[model samples]
Target: MTIAFISDIHGNFEALKAVLAEIDRMRVAEIVCVGDVVGYYSQVNECCDELRRRGIPSVLGNHDWYLGYGGFCTRSRSVNECLVYQRKVITSENVNWLRAFHLQMQMDTVRIVHAGWSDPIDEYLTNPSEDYFARLSGTHFVSGHTHVQSIHRFGGKTYCNPGSVGQPRDGDPRAAFATFDGETFALHRVAYDMQKVFDRMEAAGFHDYYYGGLKTGAKNLRRLAD
Candidate 1:
């Protein structure tokens, strides 16, 4: 059975739709989300509704926690600003759904978390060492944060990050995801209509500062010149 993994949607419905279409075409048997269902984009409600409609199981991401529970992000002021805007537009039902997400999940042998195992909601697994993977108790682990797609193998164990569907930061301006076929994790990228996202963000009153890096897949969020 092939299981598709998606993460960090961040309210980009166009990207999410494109990814889902690809997953459907690939005939994946199951789909799971690593979270960040709402953030950094304008279609927060649409993204949430799609995921919930598909009954995708997802872990709690830091952004989701913030919007769902009224928390704040200290790492990025832009993130907090986006959260503030999202809160006003997101439905109460969607907020309730986001609040119900778990910190971690165990799907047979595959352990899933939104960020890292130690701090599921906020750790960016950018450069984990062999020791870090060794301490983990599972052969297959999945996480999504950092918006970078990656796979690390250590001591016969494997870790995979499906990357970000909404805001990719891996130097590849494409929607990113992964698939597990009970053995290896395969990374995939699909191009989507980014202009639609831009238009919607503009209509929603967000400036280019919120989405400029999406075209180049820059590691950091775009900011205005100093």
Candidate 2:
């Protein structure tokens, strides 16, 4: 059985659709989300509805928590703007779904979480310390928070981050995901209607920087990730 992993789908329905199609083409048996099903874009409900409809299990993300309760982290002005708009437009049912996400899930020897295991909601474990790596018990540790696709191996543990499905920060702007079949791990990316997403974001009162950054695969976010 192959398990497909997706994460950081920040409400871009177009990208989600494309990624789902790609997953379908791969004939994956199980699908799981690492979270951030909302924030920084339009179609928050649409994305949430799709995931809920498909019965995909997802872990909690920081943005999902913010949407469920209130307030933003020390983020950008535009990010806060988008969150405010999302709060205004999101449905109660979708909010409930986002709020009900599990912090971490374990399947066999594989462990999945939105971010790191220590501080699941807020931490970014791109460059984990030796002590942290020593604590990692699973053969495979899957997470997504940096919006950058990566696979790291250290201390007999393999960490796989499938990147951002909605807002990829890598040099490639396609929707990023990965699949693992207990042996081989495969990473895949699919193209979506980014212009349509940009237009919708603009219609919803977002500025061009969102589109520009997404278009260029978030060169600005590289600094933050590094």
Candidate 3:
């Protein structure tokens, strides 16, 4: 089965639309989202509605937790501030969906999580070694959170990250995603209309930095993909 994986959408409807179009062109059997469906952008409700409409399975992201559960303080002070601002504008339905999301999912050959399987929703395994993969007990482990797209082979297992679809932090402005065709994995980056998103953010009256981040894909005053 060909499964297309995308993550860290962060509520950019334009980016998600472009990615879905590309996925249709690829004729993927299924589309799986690695989460962070809300946070950082202005179209949280639309993004969540679209994901639900498409019947995509998703794991919970840190941003989703903060927005839904009101516990961003436990994650990071800066993230807390961002979530606090987002909460004021987010709709009630989207918040409810995020609150009920799962942290991890296990499929036949693929294990999906917003972060590492060991730590689930919170910990990030950016450079998990051979020992880490050996302990996981899955042929393929897919995760996203760091917003850097990479594929790692350790022991007998393969680890794949699709990066961020809307808020890509890998130094590339193009939206990043990945596809797994049972045996092989391929990363894809697609260009979208950034100005359109920027205009929306402006009209919504979001923080200036929020819209600027979309243009550069940088966060926390750091360049993309620190």
Candidate with top TM-score is 1
Evaluate residue 60 in candidate 1 and report its C-alpha lDDT on the 0 to 100 scale: 96
Worst 10 residues of 1 by lDDT: 217-226
- lDDT for every model? 0.90, 0.84, 0.81
Candidate 2: list runs displaced more than 4 Å. Answer: 129-131, 221-226
Output the lDDT of residue 204, model 3.
72
Ranking by lDDT: 1, 2, 3
Which order, best to worst by TM-score? 1, 2, 3
Candidate 3 lDDT, 20-138, residue by residue in tens: 99999988869999989987777888899999888887899878887888865464454555567678878788788788788888766989999887767767777778887887676
TM-score of each: 0.97, 0.94, 0.91
Give all candidate RMSDs, comma-separated: 2.0, 2.0, 2.3
lDDT of 2: 0.84
Better of 1 and 3 by TM-score: 1
